[model samples]
Target: MDFSIISENLHYYFDGLLITVQLTGISLLLGLIFAIPLAVLRTSRNFILTMPIRFFVYVFRGTPLIVQMFIIYYGLGQFDFVKFGFGVFQEGFNPDNIGNQTFLWKYFFSEAYFCALFAFTLNTCAYTIEIIRGAIESTPFGEVEAAKSVGMSRTMMLRRIILPSSLRRAFPAYGNEVIFMLHGSALASVITLMDITGAAGIINARYYAPYEAYITAGVFYLCITFTIVWLFKKIEKRIYAHLAPYVDKTQKTAAVN
Candidate 1:
């Protein structure tokens, strides 16, 4: 257990930590943004509006995150259209011809970082949609009835009441989702993205100190987990403060006496 190797290469781990946080943070933010509208649509009775979203959610949620990342990173490159560009499919099929590659393929899909980001966004978005949809669906009937009684339009009611309440209710669950995404970001290392786990792997490879390398990575993850837990607890307390039971000071004093 030569832990000295970890101290020597601490900078690598810090760099990896930045990548992990950036990857996870961006993915979660984008996922939440996309999920908001999709979740509302999911709660709708309209099949046309809901089916496509349902299928998308099903496909992403049903599959493994690592498999999704691999398909995005490696599978897309296998296609000639992506490799050689649209010309291969459009003009003529020539095995030797390296056609003009697309800007999208060259700029985004061809890169490991973009591929991982794409996968992470889609994966997190799918889960977030379901999390919010469930929260929206679980909204109390009385509230809906009260809103309807007041002649509140569907849009107005959702904006003013349903959404606010549902979001508050979903806060804790969403916090958990954020943490899951953080842990899942480790998969980015598999695609050679140089995340925290990737840094540890490199250290282990060079020094042959598996315990030291991996344990240092584990400690970093644990610290992150604790910080997340603390932040969520604080936010939950603030958001749910109104729901906390109020006790009269006089009553407490009387009880004490």
Candidate 2:
């Protein structure tokens, strides 16, 4: 209702929205970079190769993203390995008058933004690998055999057929993951990342109007969500257009008209 408050704080919202978008984008990029290879290895029968991926996926998926962020940003700070990881740099950065915290401790744990990004990447990758793996496994044996009959090598089949088709099938689920990561970026506020939720918090504190502050933030999130859905729908129509054979064109036309 208090639109003026939002107008006054527009700059804060803009900065926070940018931070949220950046965090989600970076996390998805990192997750995608690792998840593909990890998914392939995860499908392998070799326990040695697969076990590590499995364990990583399990741990990340099993735990809360917030907990992971805390462990990296705070919990690991309690350990000597993390503390002494870069001793030389640690000593160089330390100065007197800073209470109880050392240079290394402050350097690693003090960066909540980095910690949140790292945690989001790890968590999203865990879920994404599974999404991709399921898609890959769902690829028909007949199609693979058809590729083989056409003289495609295993590597060629994967690169040209399986990977591409699997990704297409995985897109809908992957899009949901992207949106989830966007919303999850709000948790960054807990650690002072100044994301959308953080901006909303600041607004509430400044104006003493939680309704106005949070409703505006909610509108921003809703707009982002709608945009993502529209994009995904466009992608889905493009990728799945090959289903024309199973669908009756006349009925489709009639339904559309």
Candidate 3:
């Protein structure tokens, strides 16, 4: 219908798409980095090491992502410490008379962007921990026995065997997690971050064309989903190459024809 409106505001959608990618990419990277060590620790028998990580994962995975974003974005400002910019200013403070001291609060809870990133990072990290933990626990019993026979210490076995093998096994599941994270990034718009969904909402409000606005946004998301699926498929094939049944090239070509 209103193709002209979409054409006119294509740049806005592109900008929003960029923000969406940045948010998802950074969140996934940080989540994976933190989850690796936490997952390893989570498999330990010691309650001291495992309980805190378990509780962290439980709380994040148990709550809605929107609630987490709200608590980080709107709730933090209610505190006097964050409200006053970590004590740099008080009530009715003037921007013109700002102090020279660097304030750490301004970069974190004080900004919607950082708050959204913080929430997404922690939320994805919680799920990722469980994904990797399951992979680690599922390591074949014979492999563990072989490692023990060769006098491999826990640390050495994890380093040389368990982590590498587990990570490969977790690859498919993690790809799904990445896709979920991309979809979840839509919630960033709720916190005033102009992600793809945010751009669509703005267009719908301004032009009164809900179908055009949202369908365009949906197309963008679909394209991203396709790209992610293709990339992950490539990586998954490589990761599990050894398990694939060998096929003659001549037969493959004949089937294709």
Clashes found in each candidate (C-alpha, N, C closer than 3 A): 0, 0, 0
Task: Give the Cα-based TM-score of candidate 3 against the true structure.
Answer: 0.90
lDDT, model 2? 0.87
lDDT (Cα, 0-100) at 7 in candidate 3: 95
Q: Kindly list the per-residue Cα lDDT of model 1 for residues 70-139, writing each as its tens digit.
A: 9999999888877766667665567474446677887899889889999999999999999999999999
Sort the predicted structures by TM-score, highest score first: 1, 3, 2
Clashes of 3: 0
Itemize residue pairs with steric clashes in candidate 1: none
- Give a tens-digit lDDT track for model 2, residues 25-121: 9999999999998998888899999999999999999998888988888787666545544442565644333454556566645688778888999
- The best candidate by lDDT is 1
Q: Is candidate 1 or candidate 3 better by TM-score?
A: 1
Best model number under TM-score = 1
lDDT of 1 at 54: 96
Taken over the whole model, the C-alpha lDDT of each candidate is 0.92, 0.87, 0.90
lDDT of 3 by residue, 32-103 (tens): 999999999999999999999999999999999999999988987766555444444556654444352236
Descending-lDDT candidate ranking: 1, 3, 2
Error of 3 at 159 (Å): 1.4
Worst 10 residues of 1 by lDDT: 91-100
- Give candidates' CA RMSD values in order: 2.2, 4.2, 3.3
